[model samples]
Target chain A: MIGCYDFCGHYEWTFEWLSQLGGHTLVRAYWDEAVHQDSQTHASKLIREKGFEGMKEYWGPTLADEGAVYERTVTDDVFRIDMHECPSKGFLLRNGLEQYRDYCDHCMGWIGPLMKDAGFVIDHEHNHCGQCWWEIRRKDDATPASAAGELSGASDVRLRPGWQSPHTDHYERSTDPDDKTVVS
Target chain B: MASSIPASLPYADTKPAGHADFYFAVNATFRFILRHHGEGALRKYWQDIGQSYYQPVSKRWSELGFAGVAEYWRAFFAVEPGAEVEVSEAQDEVRLEVKTCPAIRHLREHGREVVPNFCQHCFFVNEAIAEPAGMTVRVCGGNGSCTQRFMKATADLPPQNLEDIATAS
Candidate 1:
């Protein structure tokens, strides 16, 4: 899921306004700023310590190896995994999130493909919460009918519900866990 | 034109006497129609109202947006007081305009910089766009071009999943 911390540049102006009105006591007003700032910093630190290249590559092919690809709006199952990034190496069990877990059934599941599809492939994956080690992957496949253009438009004008208030709480920042899995 | 209520219009605990009658009647009519027919009737009712008002109201139907007709009706009722309103089949596409009055008020009370609206990325999210990895989009609330596009979270699959050879292979 594209959380709030992705676009820090655009929110700088909003923060300036909130800071003036809130002053020192404007904890609510500065919450988003604080979250974005912290996430960016944390992400950068992780990048530096690992000496990884680019945002996408930071996870390395090792993480991508165990990836799963699901069909467009199909089901709660994964199709495949690379041996290098498999749970045998323990990466899947360590960094998995929870949002990927809840689904058609309450049972635990991975989000890889059991078969190969034509237009789409897995793009990014995360666990539901940082528990249970079930992997969830965000699939990136285009529909057959004008899928490319539709996706381009979908990316700009209509993604989430239009009525979401701007002041909702932002995503929380968690420090790198000692239990977190890292691959060289 | 309807009279503009003072910015500091007194907040009343009870409905105004004269307006209360129409308000109650309207509310009751809505409830009665909704109770028997469900929301379908209300939607049709509004559609009919849109059709009736389409011609006599204005030539810029699209510009009227959702609020335009609503405002027109509000103004019409204020003047006519007891006019019986009805609508028929109407063919028009109405646009909805987002109001930033709360944002405006916050700016006025607090300071110029206060963002009375959500972040640009958030705006995209509200529109159902999720990732916004590429593509250039211009934001309306403030100045500057917001380059982010919208994307979506992956869909959850159903239970008893099948390994579509298309997906699995």
Candidate 2:
């Protein structure tokens, strides 16, 4: 059987497989339909019912379970995560497994839709090398993404050395994964 | 450095056990593939994964034979949380009696709708892995529990009957 022990490995490979089968559109649909709707419905329900609190509830145990090194900074208006070490990306990096073009987009691919359904928007960025930050707020809040250390002080991921890479992708108040602005 | 890794498993992770929530994605992938590409395509996906992504495993089994099959399954299921399985090895074959399939049980507990043909993945994937290794596998029973036998290619085993496998709910 295809066990989940190496799920991230196969999951990343599957992205390339689906992309080859029906191109980028199929990959996007897989994330929205299979990932966001069918697979991660529990996350959808939690975030929808509880809003920002649900995100906390969801990511707290999830990141911990997946053995992520990160910090969460939350205020009344927004929920933010500073991922110093993302477990999934770390797994692929450690194992030298890269089949798809951009595996990180998958996060926004699913979570973006989930946030939109929950009446919120996201400000996010990730370096291809497994470090990223996410700031989520209610759609009507209109607060901009915070500057480095504005929310989490020393815990800010963007302030880390080499945080900005030549290939960082940024999403500003966006809910669609493809809405990223490339940074060189 | 290479010797530190488990001989049976091709990949290694920092964690001892896997995040069980991934089973949900596995189920969803099956549903999506079947819906879009149909059964033949779905089977091709499984076979492809077994041949490609699991190439390392096939190589190991080719070198180690029946002993490798037993060792691999034992270690494979060990990290799959909620799995209740026994891998018994004899002179000629190895058998896996899956008492509680982790994916099926997890999907069921979460009230997820399972694809009816989900059980067939094991056969197609394992067959692909075994064929290239000069071995063969037969899978019977399924849904939540099943039996899988791995033996030499020349062993006079009958062809697997899909009807013997239980359809997933």
Candidate 3:
């Protein structure tokens, strides 16, 4: 049976497989339809109904269950996450499994659409080395992403050494995975 | 959680058990494929993954034989939370009596709509994996409980009937 014990490995592999079968359009549809709409309906519902509080309710136990090393900072205006060690990405890295061009985009692929539907936007970046940060806010707020250590203080992922990478992908106040700009 | 993974598993992770929520994605993936591409494509996806993504496990089974197949399942289920399976190896074959499939249990608990042909994945994927190892597998029952038998290709086992596998809700 295709057990969930190595779900990340196969999940990443499936992305490349689907991409091969139908290209990036198919992949993006899979994330939005399968992941965002179908798989993560609970997250979509939570955020859609409660907004910022929903993110907290959804990610807190979920991340802990996945064994992520991360910190969440929430205020009335925005919900921020400093992902020091992303469990899913860490699993792929440790196992040397890289099938898709960018595994990290999957988060935004699903979450970005979810946030857009929930009247929010996200500012996020991932280094492909299992380190990333996210700041989500109301779309109309128009506030830019906070500087390093400004929101989460010392717990900010940017302040850590090796956080920057030539492959680092950054997104401003946006809700589309394709909106990312690669930073050296 | 076990500090060390069993040697039979091809990949390793810091956490012993996987996040159960991923089962939702698996089911969703099937739904996506079935809706857009159709069932044949979905089954082909399963076969491809079994042949490609699980190439290492198949290679190990080829080298180690039936003993390797038994070891792989035992180790595979160990880290799967909520799985209750008994893998017994005899001279001719290895049998797996699954009382509670972890994916089915988790998906059911969360009220996810399971794909009707979900159980067929076991047969298609396992058969592909066993093919290169000079073995064959037959799966019976499903939704929540099932029995899988793995034996050498030379064994006079009948072809698996799709009706034998129960449809998942």
Candidate 4:
């Protein structure tokens, strides 16, 4: 039985397996089709129906259930999250499991398409070390990502020491995982 | 996390139980593979994962035999929320009587559409894992509950019939 107890380990392994079988295109399709459309349809439905409030409703309990150490800042115009220790990534790191080239891209891979469908865009960055920040806003809002300590005050992930790494990947007002730029 | 996790488990996590929502991904992954690649590819994927990703478990089973299989399943099910299983070990075999499968229960409770061949994964994956340990497994019944028998390969044992495995809704 493929139990969920170690789902992250196998999930990361499956990414590399898919990539090896059909390259990056298959992996991207898996995220969009399998993850965003099929697995996370509930998330899609919530965000589609409730917008920013939906983001809060969806991530709040979900992150807590997954045992993530994170903070959320929500306003009428935007929804932001500062992830200190992402449970999924932290699981892989603690277990020394790394099969995919960039495991963090999976967040954008599924969430990007969901946000695109929800009429919003995202400004996000994740260091390979289980720390990241996200700012989500309406597509027409044109607001850039909040600076460190701007939206969430001192709770911003960027304010943490060693927040920036050579492997940090950044996205600016984008809804596609491929749009990231290496910060180093 | 390491201190809390049992030695039998190949992987460890900070949380005691996994996020049950991940069952959605497992189901979705099967549907995606079957839709795009076909059944053979899906089976191959399962076999490959059992052989490669679970290599450590297989090695442990080889080293410890039936005791390893019993310990592994007991520890594995302990952290799987909503699972109800009984694992028993004998001189020649390790038997698992699954009263409620966690993945199936979670998926069904949330009204997710399960893949029809979902239960076949247990056989394919377990077989792959057992092969290297000089053992074999037979899974009977499925969908929600099943019986799995792991024992040394013997000529008297009959080949598993796919029909014995129930199709998941």
Per lDDT, the best of the predicted structures is 4
Using Cα atoms, each model's DockQ against the true complex is 0.01, 0.72, 0.72, 0.87
Q: How much TM-score does chain B earn in each model?
A: 0.28, 0.95, 0.96, 0.98
Candidate 1 CAPRI classification by DockQ: incorrect
Candidate 3 residue lDDT tens string, A73-164? 99999999999989889989888899899999999999999999999999999999999999999999989999999999999999988788
How displaced is residue A21 in candidate 2, in Å? 0.5
Q: What is the DockQ of candidate 4?
A: 0.87
Give the TM-scores of the predictions, in the order they appear: 0.17, 0.97, 0.98, 0.99
lDDT of 3 by residue, B1-169 (tens): 2249987998888887878898999999999999999999999999999999999999999999999999999999998889999999999999999999999999999999999999999999999999999999989999999999998887476888999999999
Best candidate (score: DockQ):
4
For candidate 3, give the lDDT of residue B145: 97
CAPRI classification of candidate 4? high
Name the Cα RMSD for model 4. Answer: 0.9
User: Which candidate has the highest TM-score of all?
Assistant: 4
- Give model 2's DockQ, 2 decimals: 0.72
| Candidate 3 ranges with C-alpha deviation above 4 Å | B1-3
Q: Write the per-residue lDDT of candidate 2 for residues B37-156, one digit (tens) a residue.
A: 999889999999999999999999999898889989988998899999999999989999999999999989989898999999999999999999998888899999999999888756
